[model samples]
Target chain A: MSEPISGKSLHGHLDTMVLAVLDKSEAHGFEVWKRLEAQAKGGLKLKEGSLYPALYRLETAGLLTARKEEDDSSRRGPRRRIYKITRKGKRRLDQGRQEWQHFVSVVECVIGAPA
Target chain B: MQDLRVHVEKAVRPVVADQGTKLRMREELYSHLLEVFEEERATGDDEAAAILRANDRLGDPAALTAELQATASRVSWYEGAIDRIVHRQDETEIGHACRLASRYLLAIVPLIIVVVPTVWIIQTLIGSTQKSFLDLVSDSLWFGVPFGVFATAQVFFFTIIAHRMLRQFDKPSWRPRSIGGVFGLCAVSTVFLLVSSFALFSILTGNPRATYELMMPKWLIASSLMPFVMTGFVLARRREIERLEPWSSLEIADET
Candidate 1:
């Protein structure tokens, strides 16, 4: 597990992270969460419950579309709903990525990278 | 699994009153937790241990509910409160009635506060002609018109509010749609009829002088029926609400 990011730090970045996860392919809540955790090396400290709201908010904002998908794998369970990035979502993602890059540059300039 | 479901329901109920969102949330959470449990069990964890582990990972209920509510489209306080009261699963008919009455009563509080004094001041300026203060209030058609208009307007406003609140924030399947206007009309009518009958009987049997004064002239009585007509209007509006697209299957594909 990677070191968990503080809740304060995670606040604004969650939507960006969620959209980036969906940038690869459509995935349900669990798949998106697993990929996020893996990417963060378990340092993300993202709560399962909190993750859902981010997905929902993004979906509500028209940045993503969600549809019910039947669970077809051997591990039988209730149907899972997958979220796919909409055209709007992609545009927002690009905006979000640019904003993040500018933010990182400013912070790095201020604090200076590890000597 | 049962524990997970109970946790999810408790966490989600207050925040997501809409049936479609609630059901989808519950299913999604349950499926996620079950997967966690299964993965734990595969790693030589016992069933109880897996369940315990999965439950812990679900997070704080209050925080989660708040997070979800914050992110979703905002529902106003009255809308959410009225929605919960009307659509609650265990509420009985009596309970529902009381909740609705209290809610409507609260909505009318400002009008009552304003109207009573305004009427009193108007009467004071005009100078009291009747024997008692109560008689002054009871005998005047001028006071009655304002009271009736304001009160009827309040009823109309609240009826639309109730309909809009339910239609926008709650799913039809959670509470019976028929509860809105028809049931309210029947209840109001029953009370109105009983009181009017009692008053009519009292006037006929008890006092001839009182009969002439309190029975009201035919024209006034006809005008007084405006509230009932407004009630019919509210009922028709509720029927219109019934035809609104169910929030269950529909998705907002775009902001436009």
Candidate 2:
């Protein structure tokens, strides 16, 4: 079995990943975690608690906005702070994607491609 | 639900953030924990086992708290003002330092306003018996400069203690402990300053009579009252700011 990518190793990319997740649709904290988990397909190992600080950082930077609303879907739960990415956040994600591609190409060139 | 709430509280307890941020964090964390717990239960685990598994997946509370604090939304009005003033994108490093220094000086304005005039009046009355104008001026500078410096230092010390005490007010669990800590600090600082002033006076004049008659009573009163006075002022200013700008509005982004 392949070793799962630890969340610690993905710290720099977490912001972009979060932006990417939110770009699909606005989601509350739990839903974001669920989607990320589903998308990573067991290749990513993330602690649930670590997601909040990233959310807060993004919100503070005006890259995303959040508001609390009642979750009708949940039978027993508090109001969820639904987060959505801002236009600036979309621009940042585009930039991040381009940079990531360039970085991958450089590394692949140096490493002579994956086996 | 209650179990998840308790878990969230323990996890977020160590985060030193404003009350609003803490509440939002607690609610969000609790919501997430509940979801995790329910998912675990669906896998046939009992309530206790599901809760345990959910918490384990949430990771260590201390580590989470540290991360949360790192990105903690700053809600203090002074912090907001300072960031606005000092953190301009175009501002150079030296300009940033200078602006911060100026803000520190501005913070001590009340201290200077209260202390300088009081020191002058006391010096004038004490030196009334002096034969020459030069003697009075000399006496004022001799006593006033050191007193002013000591008073400034005391104000800063009390302000720091008061800031910490005020921060504690955000955590309901910490309120009683904070009050006791404040009183303890006040008593300790009073005693410490009294002894230090006596030593300072003796070293300056080498005359116990002069120190006792000239400085001790008034200086002692001022030094002893300073902690209470500063704490009261900080509390009052905080209340006024809260009145003007509600804590809810201090969040970085308005609700959408």
Candidate 3:
């Protein structure tokens, strides 16, 4: 099996990716993890510890808000917390996406790849 | 839940400041670990195996804790100063007391470097008897005692004010009143430190009269008042801190 993307490579984009995942749909911590893995096609394995801190930092920065709700689907466990992207989060995501695209375009151009 | 909590507690290790923050972080991390354990169990791992695997995947707890500390807003300056004094995160009460004593002594080094020369320049320019407002109050043996007593009271009040103030970041309903009480204590402590140091320097330089005139009152007041005043303040505030911190955990009172 291929090694997961190292945290060093993902560190810069973690906040943006978290915002993107939440932007698609509100998710609890685990749900967000699952979607991130799927989005990365199983290559973007995240350290479980780092992910929640990022979510918390984003929440503290006013880019996200969280609410706890009963997990009706599960019989016996704790309530699930759902985190949603705020308007500020959407704006940040747009900026991050633009930056990422620009960076990729510049790198690809240097490598003589098709646009 | 118990296992997950124990794992997290072991990882975070001696969490100081903001009980509410620590508890909330633990619960959120616990829920995430439980989800990971469930996924591992789905793959036919036993309960123990699932837990082990999940814990491994979470990365180092120490690293996670450092990151969390970095992300959290700074503790109030009063709390920061008090932490230096008391070494609040240390394991034993004796350790805390010793750390407090050592830190106060260390404060003298800074006084010698910064305060002494400034005082010398001011005194040379103004005259021998020239006194700042702090000097006049500190000069009286009678006033010095009450001033020390008042400063001691102010420290107690300011600590509460600082802790509750930081608690406001988490609690929108709680608003802090004037922080000048704490700043006032800081100012008093600074003057007290410098005057004491300057007098000590004078006595060592064969100027014992200056010691009698300036340092005696401070020593008499501070040495006599500080211990009782600090003890009383701690004892007095110990019971009432709970009502003050809405967001703090129930266990914080015991810890304090």
Among these predictions, the greatest TM-score belongs to: 1
Please write out the lDDT profile of model 2 over residues B1-256, one tens digit for every residue: 5556656666665566544566678778877888899899999999999999999888777778788878875443344345445544446445555555555655566555576567667766897553455555577668766665565555555555555555545532333346776777677667767776787677668796889888888888877795776467656666444532322233322111
Model 2, residue pairs in steric clash: none
Task: By DockQ, rank the candidates, best first.
Answer: 2, 3, 1
Candidate 1's displacement at residue B213, Å, is 40
TM for every model, in the order presented, reads: 0.56, 0.53, 0.55
For residue B191, model 1's alpha carbon misses the true position, in angstroms, by 24
Better of 2 and 3 by TM-score: 3
Which lDDT tens digits does candidate 3 get at residues A56-108?
88998999999987657753344667999999999999999999999999988
- By DockQ, the better pick of 2 and 3 is 2
Which ranges in model 1 have alpha carbons more than 4 Å from their true place?
A71-77, A113-115, B75-79, B86-89, B93-256
Q: Report the lDDT of model 1 for residue B205.
A: 52
Question: DockQ of candidate 1?
Answer: 0.46
For residues B1-256, what per-residue lDDT tens digits would candidate 3 score against the true structure?
A: 4565556665543344354456567667777888888889999999888888888888777777777766656552333444544664423534544544444444444544575457656776878756664564344434334444444443444454334333333233333344554345445544554465555446454586776676767765654554344345544544345333322322322222
Model 3 interface root-mean-square deviation: 1.5
Give one digit per residue, the lDDT tens place, for model 1 in B66-108: 8867754544445455666555445654455555555555556
Model 2 chain B: worst 10 consecutive residues (lDDT sum): B247-256
> Per-residue lDDT tens digits of candidate 1, residues A1-115?
4457966779889999999999999999989989998988768766687889899889989999999897488765567889999999999999999999999999998899676
